[model samples]
Target chain A: MKHTLPILIRKEVTQFRRNKVLPRIVVMMPLMLVLVLPLVTQMDVKNISVAFIDHDRSPLTLRMESHLAHSNYFRLCEPVGSFEEAEQMLDDGKVDLVVSIPEHFERHLTLGDPKPILLEANAVNATKGAQGMQYALQTIASAAMEKARGRGAAIGAEQLLTVENRYNPTGNYRHFMLPALMIVLLILVCCFLPLLNIMTEKEHGTIEQINVTPVGRLEFILAKLIPYWLLALVLLAVAMLLAWAVYGLLPAGAAALVFLAAFLFALCISGFAVTIANISDTMQQAIFVMFFFVMFFMLMSGLFTPIDSMPRWAQGITYAFPPRYVIDVFRSVYLKGTLFAELWFDFLMLTLLAVVFNLLATVTYKKQS
Target chain B: MDNIITVSNLTKQFGSFTAVDHITFAVSRGEIFGFLGANGAGKTTAMRMLCGLSKPTSGSGSVAGYDLRTQGEQIKRHIGYMSQRFSLYEDLTVAENMELYGGIYGLSRREVSDRVDQLLTALQFADHRDDLVGSLPLGWKQKLAFMVATVHRPELVFLDEPTGGVDPITRRQFWDLIRAAAAQGTTIFVTTHYMDEAEYCHRISIMVDGQIRALDTPAVLRARYGADTMEQVFYRLAREAKRGD
Candidate 1:
């Protein structure tokens, strides 16, 4: 038992290296995620088209139009002569938003009875529409405030509420996305490698040879898992380096803590993969089962969205996903410098998942029938 | 001679269908025992039970003096099995496959290397020691599989249709390896569809419908059935049996 595992691991690693395409894919996937995914998902919804119909044509309205045009978030189209033309553009999908300044807009402001500024947003893509509308609102509000302050009217500070975005002061999206991408890459490699490796052996009839031997069941599974586990760690290291070099992001907490989390997470996923392989009789069955579980785990892992924001039942399902804890630990440690003491729940969850998955894999893998 | 394998009323069933109905047999030490059956005739199923790969549905058996019911692990450690698929890791080199099986059988590193070198040289596979088993021709692969199965020097080795799809020349060469192993006092339990190969066995059992219809030496079976060839003997028994092929 002592020496059998090493031999088996060596055999697996040798076979892994011998495969012409799989090793390259395993390494290239993480590199692509670290280098390319962050850039792709870093989109901030810029250059939104806006059409203006200013009836007043006053200096105040003109100033508002210029301010909206100069802002990076909105692309101001040529000033339309009438509201009808602005509405036409909106309906044609040429513009995402329309701002209309009513007649006598500046006169009402001088009398302290300001007329409402009507804004129409094309909400075809709801999130983008909402974001474009918010940008337009901020631009107009700040322009109005500048005009009021220029006239020497006292603007009350009572309604102002100061906001602070701690930890990620700049709200760098890369910092959030890179860690999530790392988790995703790790889960994919760690899970599929062992699943496919074992299934391939079964397909090739090599498993029957191993089954007839005296190799312990746990030893056989561990031997099959350790190669991919170590490969996943290597992938993690490469991804971390690429993240720092390409995105300039690093974990703010102890590097060892990040490694610990990644190792535990890899163990949990690989164990789950082995269990899948054990139950499946063919490569197709294993791949389909793996695909189903991986998709479910990724969606419920809160990698793309927050767990708390999901529906109550959906959030309850998130607790069953092992990657959810890893993602939480990754974000906390990377951005907030959270220590182990504060992250005991995540560590405990990951540890429990690892134990359960590995035990199940070992128990489910039958050497004799 | 001491019996290396003793099976009594061994049976296996899947739901209502019996695959290996209560059949009994014994194999003497260093003897070449041939287990013959048609497709789905329960030869492989019976071999699996004897190899400890599957449990008997009823009755009792022992392999290498280990109880089939409780000492399956011990039984496995003491026996070698080669299935019809030629179960060698194709992705691994010839020497690597040898080392892997040796290591699994709990051999020391030095012992594994020494045995691998000796076997490769003796089998004229020294030049291809580092070549992947997949790159080798089918005949060489089968021969290498046979060698790897007996690398641990087990007291008994089970070969389940080891020559299923090989040429007659290759099959003849394979039987040479089996005979050579038997000469060294390693009991060889083989199954073959080729009647000529069955002729090479010291004793052969023809099974029909999950029951052993004939268990005797080839000469004895031929004389009893009054047939000129083992194929005639097999056909005579199979036709007389009250079962559809």
Candidate 2:
């Protein structure tokens, strides 16, 4: 086993170097994900572009107009004369929210029960458009309150200024995206390498070479595991270092602990990949299987959205994904300076995952059965 | 010669279809035994069970004195196999590929170095030791795949259509390596459709549809079938099987 270790690692690295796409898909991709992807990817939902039509021509409607102009969450893009004009602006993608102060606006307000201001919100984009409409209503309501009650009975300004975003205090997108990307890329590289490695053997029929050698089933599996495991660890190290050097996102936890967790995470992911490789007879089938899991894991891993924002069932489903725990451990350490004790459960789940996947691969593997 | 391989009613099935039906055979030490069949004729299936890559459904064999059923680990420790494709790692230098196989077989680092040195010197390509195996010609790659397969010095070696793509000259060179290994006391269990290749084997078994149709030396198979060449004998047997089907 000691003799085979370096030999396998060297062989894997040599093979990885020869294959043009493998290393890029593994290491470079994750680095790019962390650096390039999140900088431009938007997360904030503020300052929605909307248009208004105040046909009432009254003092109350004018006050409402002034209120919208001052609101931070909205930018009133070029108001129009009629509701149809606002609709045309929305169709042309100029405005996301269309607000109409009704013709009976003053009459309704004097009765002390105003008819609702017509708000047509485009719900196509889901988040930004809806928030834009909500902000418009809130600003208009505050204006109405000022008109109904004269000056001097104002509520005191209460300071509500406590905010600390967990993983990104500096609000750095690279710091947030890169840490999660390290996990994604390591998995992409390590996971798919083993899958293709084994399937290529089977396709070329070198599996028979391992079968006849003095290497046992356990030995063969472990030998293949070495190259990929080391490659994944190296990629993980490089990714973290890149994050640190480029974005100034230092690992809050010990570097050694982060490495150990990441190392174990590779084994879990590689085991699952090799199991797929063992069963898939062709490279095409192997890649299809890998793509399915890669998409499923990355899209639902709670890297972009808070788990709280997900439906309860979706949040529950992500628990079964190994990347979920892997990402949590990474963010906990990278963003919060969290120690191992604070992140013991995530680490434990990852370790358990590694064990389960390894055993499952071993058990499912047999010579000819 | 002592029996190096023993099989008794060894069978394997995928669901209901038995790939290798109950059949018994043995090969003596240093003998070149042939496993012949058409495509999907259960030749590879039988070889896989004996090699301990797959489990037998309801039979047993002993490979290098280790029970195939109960001691696959013990079996693996004493066998070598080569497939028909370019099996050597194309990315690594020839010596590195040798080191990997030798290490996996429990060779000491020093032993791998020694064995690789011996092989490179004997093959008389000492300068090509560090060249990537992929850049080499097909003939060299085949020889290297064969050499690496036997680097651990296992008791038995199974060659599954090991020369399917190579030209006749390269195939002849590959046979010389097989013969040299046999001279070194390694039992060879090989399967090939090439009649000329079968003529060189010590004994040949012609399998059709999961059963051995003929088991004899190349000369005897021709004599019994009244055919001047092994190809004629094979053609006659295949025709008979097809007509029977």
Candidate 3:
């Protein structure tokens, strides 16, 4: 079995080299994600177009408009003369928000019964709309507070909360996304490569030749997986290099611990891929099965959204996914410099997944059939 | 002569359909045994049982003195199989294919290198050793596949329509290689749809609808059916077959 494994791996490597497109794609995918996706997803809504219509035209109203313009989030467009003109600008998509001051704005403030200013927002994209409204409100509230203090009136004490973001002081999104993207790339190469490799053998009829030989089923599966496993590790290293060069991010924990977790995670995914390949009779069937599982795994893995925010049942399903554990390990290792002792439970689960998946794959693969 | 393969009342059923029904056959050592049948006539199914690839539904068989039931791994080790698909890794080179199969059969590294060298030289494939098998013509690929299958020097080899898509000249050359292997005392069990190729076997069996309808020497079968050729003998039996699929 030892001798056969090297030969089988060599054959796979040769075939992999012969296919000119795959190697390039494997390298390029991670590099593109590292370079491009971070820049795209780092977008914090800024330069939102705002139109102002001041009915009172009072000094306080002018002060509020100036504050809204000076704040980084809003970009003051041409001031409109009437509410109709502001509404027309919004309808034309010229501004994302419209701020209007009512006629009694100064009078109400003088009487100590300040009326609220109307801030209309385009709610087509709900998240953007909500964030824009919050920022606008903060600017208007501060402007009102400054006006009250200038009038020599006793102002109420406001509670101030100072938030210190640990681990990431600057709140760089790449620090969070790069590690997760690395895990995603690892999953793609480790799972899909072996799945397609085995399916190709079946399609080209070489699987029947191997089946008729005295080669053990487990040996054959191992031989097929080891090459992709090694390739995924190599790709991981390249991705790390790209991360450092492009984003200046590196794992804060022991590199060995991160790699150990990656290795186990890769093995588990590869075993799952092999089992899928064993059960599927054709390439299309195998691809469909892989697609279904990978989609589910990625969705429930907390890659894009927080697992805690998901519904209770959906959160329960995330426990069954191997990527969820691996993603946690990656984030912990990369950002927090988490020790192995702190991540022992995740490590144990990954190791267990590896063994169970490989055992199932070996038992289900039938040489005689 | 010692029997290399022996079977009695071997049967295989897929649910209600009997693919190979209560068949019995034997082949002596160093003999060229030809298995002939129409499409879906159960020739391949029966050969799969004898090669230890599939278990018989209810019967007994032995190949190379190993039990077909319990010792399938041993049977596999002692025999080589070349399927109708010409099962060679197309992306691998000719020499690499030989090395892989040689290693699979548990040959030592030195043994694999030496045997691969000798086989490449003998087959005149030395010039194309490093070229991908996919780049080779169909005939050369078939020949290379045959060589790879027998690289470990097994005692018996099963070839399933090895010359299916080759030209007549290449087919003739393939037969010469088979004859040489048989001359070296390696038993050859082959299946073919070409009647002329069936005539080259020392003994042939024509299957019809999962049963062996004729099994004898070519001359004896021709005389018994009063047919001019093995093709007519096959038609005579196949015409009366009741099974459609």
Q: Pick the candidate with the highest DockQ.
A: 1
For residues B32-121, write the lDDT of model 1, one tens digit per residue.
Answer: 999998877889999999988898899998999999888999999999999889779888999999999999999999999999998888
Q: How good is the docking of model 2, by CAPRI class? A: medium
DockQ for each numbered candidate = 0.87, 0.62, 0.77
Q: Please write out the lDDT profile of model 2 over residues A1-369, one tens digit for every residue.
A: 455555665666677787877665665675676677657675546677778898787887888888888877678777588899899888887888888888877887576565667888877888777667666766776776676566444433331113345557655556677767788777766787678788888876667666655455676777778776777787777777777777777887778777878888898888888777777778998899889988878888877666778899999988877888878888888777788888888888888988888888887775655
Q: C-alpha displacement of A201 in model 3, angstroms?
A: 0.5
lDDT of 1 by residue, A1-369 (tens): 688888888888898899999988986898789878888997467889999889888888888998998998899998789888899999999999999999999899778677888999999888788878877887887777788779898766532223456988866778888888999888888898889888988998889899999998888888888877788888888888888888678889987788899999998999899999999999998999999999988878888778888899998888878999999888898899999999999999999999999888988988888
lDDT of 1: 0.88
Error of 3 at A248 (Å): 1.8
For model 3, residues A71-161, the per-residue Cα lDDT tens digits are: 8889999878888888888888889999988897989878867676899999897767877887787787777778877988776544111
- For every model in order, the TM-score on chain A comes to 0.91, 0.77, 0.84
lDDT per residue for candidate 3 within B1-245, as digits (tens), equals 79999989999998999999988889999999999988899988898888777888998989999998889988999998999887898888888899999999989989999999998898887999899888999999989988988999999999999999899999998998899899999999999989999999999999999999989999999999999999999999998888886
Model 2 ranges off by over 4 Å:
A24-27, A45-47, A53-75, A79-88, A91-93, A99-120, A134-178, A226-261, A332-342, B37-40, B219-227, B242-245
Q: For candidate 2, lDDT tens digit of each residue in B64-118?
A: 8989898876787788877656677777789988998898889998898999998
Q: Select the stronger candidate by lDDT from 1 and 2.
A: 1
Order of quality (TM-score): 1, 3, 2
